[model samples]
Target: MKILVSGGTGLLGQGFLRVLREKGEHEVRCLVRRTSPVERLEGLELAYGDAGDAGSMVRALRGTNAFVHVAGVQYTPEVLEAMRRAGLERLVIVSSTSAHSRFEFRSAPRLVNEALLPGSGLRWTVVRPSMIYGSELDHNMHKLLRFLDRSPVFPLFGSGENLWQPVYYEDLARGLYAALTKPGTDGQIYDLPGPRPLTYLDLVRTAADTLDKKARIVRIPAEPVRRALLVAERIGLPMPVSSEQVLRLREDKAYPYEKARRELGYTPRAFKEGIALEAGRLREIGLVR
Candidate 1:
């Protein structure tokens, strides 16, 4: 099978490529911008294009049997039209569970794109994942790990009771690949989360444990942290925390992944075990120092 992937330079896109390469039978082509890094995808074929542009996507998707879209936002109509023109049938799209949460406003456009897929008379599946983490390339957990490594005292924003179910990047990638090949997946949406949920405090503590460090967690008011981060943003100082992130930190992100588990045979590792794997990888790559 010949497959084309968008968002090929992203964390999840790279992971999906790794899985595809391991299979070794399918020919994979990635849709990337001219300036996008191809180092991680050294041997894979690359199609220089943007998913939002019809002409570009159509050109890139030509002769591809299936397309995996890892982008958060896309021009769904144009993409579907391009796929149709190229005689491509299967499409697996990556969306966020936040689309169904209180933070839907931030991910509204992605939901719109997802909505366009089912009725386009095409084979489509939407995989919604919770906070994704793995490898040094990951933005979420790795950042937390780095912060925990440097700071002796860690701040637990709010009550730190909000539950979070973060899926490892590899598992999410596998889920996408499964969705691509599995039959009767058309018009279905799968929530791919870790095997279990953990509280915000537990998440931090788990990372600390993985790193073999004792974490001194202190409860901090969320409002003050948000204010400080906003001020830092205005002053052009780079900070990981954002207003949206603070809002999300306060909300529970745990969701049911039984659909994915039953349909796709998706079995994700527990957060404790997954974090240890990620830590080992980071250490092996000398990224933890």
Candidate 2:
């Protein structure tokens, strides 16, 4: 099979490329931005293109057996149209679990994209996964680790009881790969989450355990956290945790992964095991002593 992957330099995209290449059964091609660094995909075939440009996507889709539409912004309409016009009869899209949450500000765009897919002459399967972990450069987990490394006390929001299912990046990648090859997956939506759900405080405690440190969790009220996030957003902080993120942390982000498990045979690694693996990787790079 010939596969075209957009956003191939990203964490999930890179994982897919690595796995597919190792399998040696599919011819993989990556559609990358003009300014994206090519070193990440040195030996793979790369097509210079933009996801928002229909012509570029059409060219990238040439002779492709399946299209993995991983290159989408939070609230971009052009991306959805471009994928539709790219001549891909079969597509697997990566959508966030926030798309299903009422607290998500960007939920409208995702809902619109999902609604527009039927009768559009494209066989589509959308995978919505909860907080993705495993990458050292991951936005969520790594940021928490960095905070733990620098600060004596970790800030806990909303009683530290909001539940989250942090799915491993590799697991999500495998689920996407399965969706691409599996039969009767068209028009299906799979919620790919981790095996166990944990509270926000539980996540922090687990991270601290991985680093052999005691995390001093200080419970902070929601209003103050929202105000702080808003100010950070206004100042363009490099690591701005949005007000939406604050709201999300106050709500449950758990999803039913049984669909992926039963249909795609997807089984995510245990949270503790995944955290230990990431800690070992950090140690290998001398990031942690």
Candidate 3:
């Protein structure tokens, strides 16, 4: 099979590429931005183009058996249209579990992308996953790990009881590969999550445990946290943590992975095991001792 993976330089994209290449059964091509560094993809076949451009996407889609649409902006419509125009027989879209929530930041983009899939004349499979954990390249978990490493006091908003089901990056890649290869996954939506769910504070503690350290969690009121996040956003401080993120932390983000398990034979590692693996990766990268 010939596969075209968009956002191939991204964390999940990298994992997928690694898996596909190692499998050696599929011819993998990456659709990367023209300006993206190719040094990381030295030996791989790359289709140089911008995902926002339909022509570029179409050209990238040529001779590909499957299209993995992982290149998407949180609130952009261009991505959906680009995927729709790619003219692939099969498409596997990587979406977030936030799509299921009423949260403003994630709801619109997720819905818009999902809504565009129906009449695209492609065998589409959408995987809605919760906060993905694994690498330092990850957005949410990595930011939190960095914060925990740098800050003396870990701050928690809204009682620190928000449930999060963090799906591992490799697990997500496997699920995507399964969907890309499986026949029954077409035109289906699957929720991909980890084996266990933990609260915000508990998750921080787990990170600490992974590092053999204890995190000092300080609970803050939601309003104050929101105001602080507003200030942080205004100052352009590297604030990956946001009020929207904080609000999301308070919701129960767990989903039954049975669908993925049944359909894709998906089996995710426990949160602890994933965290331990991440800890080893951080140590290897000199991000942690």
Clashing residue pairs for model 3? none
TM-score of each: 0.92, 0.91, 0.89
How big is the positional error of residue 226 in model 2, measured in Å on the Cα after superposition?
1.9
Off by over 4 Å in 3: 73-87, 227-241
Model 3: per-residue Cα lDDT at residue 231 = 86
| Candidate 1: 10-residue stretch with minimal lDDT | 71-80
lDDT per residue as tens, model 2, 1-289? 8988887888788777877887788998899988987888998898888877777777888888888877763423554566566655777888877787875465776777777767566788888878788776577776677677668898777888878889888888888888888898999988888898898889899988888889997878987878887888889875546787777666787777788889999999988888888877777887765
Query: Which residues of candidate 1, in runs, are more than 4 Å off?
Result: 227-240
Candidate 1 clash figure, as a count: 0
- Give the TM-score (vs. native) of candidate 1: 0.92
- lDDT per model vs. reference: 0.84, 0.79, 0.78
Report lDDT (Cα) of residue 108, candidate 1.
81
Candidate 1 per-residue lDDT over residues 1-289, each given as its tens digit: 9999888788888788888888877999989887888786788888998877778888998888888888654567778888888878788888878777867766686688788886778888899888899866788898888788788999788999999899999999999888888887888999888888888888888899999888998888998888888888889898866777886777887898888999999999889988888888878877675
**How does candidate 3 score on lDDT?**
0.78
